[model samples]
Structure formats: C-alpha cells, structure tokens
Target: MAEVRAEMVANVWKVVVNEGDQVSDGDTLVILESMKMEIPVISEDDGVVAQLKVAEGDVIQEGDLIAVIE
Candidate 1:
C-alpha cells in the first residue's frame, strides 16, 4: 500500500479519483490550490484507491495523508 501525502499547505481544489478507482504511477489523484497555483497530487504506483482522505475545499497541511492506495 502507498500513502499519498500533501506536499504543502493547500486547499483541495479537486478530486480526480475515488475509492475503488485504479491508477498508475504519475496519474493525478487530486489538484490542490496553494498560493494561487494549482498543484497536482499524483500516484506513486499502480494501485486501487483504497481511501480518500480529503475533499474539495478542504484545507490540508504538508505531510497530511491525502489518499491511500492498495
């Protein structure tokens, strides 16, 4: 399993994948808005999305878990 974490403090702008969705490495799972910039949070390995720890408009801090892949 892999834990996807936030790279910086930001608001979750969009969620691109949901639980049970399959994703490959580099595939964007969510988009975050930080300092007026959109940053994509990507998958590190091919796996099914086991959990989504955030939602649109939610504020997240650096190192916060964003999603879990298995």
Candidate 2:
C-alpha cells in the first residue's frame, strides 16, 4: 500500500477519487487550495484507493494523510 500525503498546508478544494476507486500513478486524487493557487494531490501508486483521509473544504497541514492506495 502507498500512503499519499500533503506536501504543504492547504485547504482541500476537491476530492476527485473515492474509496474503492481504481487509480494510476500521477492521478489527481484531490485538489488543494493554497495562496490562491490550486494544487493537485496526486496518487503515486497504481491501485485501488483503499482510504480517503481528507474531505473537501478541510484545512490540512504538511505531512497530513491524504489517502491510501493499495
């Protein structure tokens, strides 16, 4: 399993994938808003999304868990 994490502090603007959704490496699982810029939180593993740890409109910090791909 691969644990996706936030790289910086941001608000979760959108959640594009759900649990049990199939995903590939580099796919955007969620979009984050920081400093008026939208940053896509990408999945690094080619597998099913086992867990979604954040929701839209959530304020998250760096190193926060985003999702788990397995």
Tell me the TM-score of model 2.
0.97
Relative to the true structure, candidate 1 reaches a TM of 0.97
Per-model TM-score on C-alpha atoms: 0.97, 0.97
Cα RMSD of all models vs. native, in order, equals 0.5, 0.5
Whole-structure CA lDDT of model 2:
0.95
Candidate 1 worst ten-residue window by lDDT = 3-12
Stretches of model 2 off by over 4 angstroms after superposition: none
lDDT of 2 by residue, 1-70 (tens): 9998999999999999999999999999999999999999888879999999999999999999999999
Error of 2 at 70 (Å): 0.3
- Residue-level lDDT of model 1, residues 1-70, one tens digit each, is 9999998999999999999999999999999999999999999999999999998999999999999999
lDDT of each: 0.97, 0.95
